[model samples]
Target: MALLDAQAIHPITLPDGTVYRDTVYLKNVIDHPRMEIGNFSYYTHSGRREDTALILAPYLGHACRERLVIGKFVQIARGSYFITSSANHPMAGFTTYPFRIFKPETFGYKDLPIKDTIVDHDVWIGQNAAIMPGVHIGSGAIVAAASVVTRDVPPYAVVGGNPASIIRMRYSSDVIDELLGLAWWDWPLDRIEANLPALSSGDMTALRRA
Candidate 1:
């Protein structure tokens, strides 16, 4: 049998074969119009399956202009949530208070700049991490626990702390470029399984050969 099942709502199976219900494949569980989740991207949350989208991105409404795009093989730990562009008030004005929202006719903030939050392939976001509006997390980046990401994270970087900053790059520029070019996440399931040794060991030569 294949190890991964994209259609499974609860993706994680324990060593004893019991399904771990807290972990859900985002693509299968989320059906929000404003959210785009790639295959095998899972989030660990205690919320009901139907509320996965809402729990992941509370501010992203169906009518909202901003999108939350999460790529393949992304692992989001418990308590992590995305704060999208819709959460922002009018910062251009003197008062941040949204006076226009009270009136039903003028509720929309169409003038506010909207930018999609993008989490690229193979990113692992640690527990309690908060991804702020408009941040683009590059492929293979690792976001540390309880971090507040306010800026763009570079490819294969290890970022941590409030207003997350890059602590270190996982690989040298050349290697990162090569791995990005490889894009193993895009491979077919059989091919991916065949390259497990190279993937797990970070064997560039073997990956290239594969």
Candidate 2:
């Protein structure tokens, strides 16, 4: 049998046979209009299952223009959240406080620029990480705990700290390019399962052979 169930809300099963309810497959639980979640992307949160979208991105509203696109096999830890483009206050004016939002008719900053946040496939975001608006996190990247990501993260990069600078690249440029081309995350479940050894062991030769 396959290890993961794409349809299951709670995907993690403990060694003792108990289901770990805190972790949920994001695609199954999230139903936001402006958010796109890929399969097997799981999030660990203690809140109610129905509140997944809100908890993950509190600033993103139903009517917001910017979208949050998360790709397949993303592993987001507890207390991590996204501050989307809609959350930004106007910078052109003298004061940052929004004066026009007081009235119902004048509410919202619809005229502001909207940039969608993209988290690519196989990204692992650590606990309490805050991804700033419009940041494009590349595939196979690892974000360290409590990092404040304000810029784009390169693929296979390990990023950490405030403003989220790249600590190191997981693989060489050539290898990274090859891996990106291979895109193991896009493979069928059976194919992925068959190549588990190479994937987990980081055996590039075996992976290429697969």
* Candidate 2 per-residue lDDT over residues 1-210, each given as its tens digit: 998788998998999999999999999998899999999999999999999999999999999999999999999999999999999999998999998789999999988999999999999999999999999999999999999999999999999999899999999999999999999999998999999999999999999999
lDDT of 1 by residue, 47-165 (tens): 89999999999999999999999999999999999999999999997999999999999997999999999999999999999999999999999999999999999999999998899
Number of the top lDDT candidate: 2
Please list the residue runs of candidate 1 whose C-alpha ends up more than 4 Å from where it truly belongs after superposition: none
Instruction: Give the worst 10-residue stretch by lDDT in candidate 1.
Output: 3-12
Q: Which stretches of candidate 2 lie over 4 Å from their true place?
A: none
Clashes of 1: 0
Assess every candidate by TM-score. Answer: 0.98, 0.99
lDDT against the true structure, each candidate: 0.95, 0.96
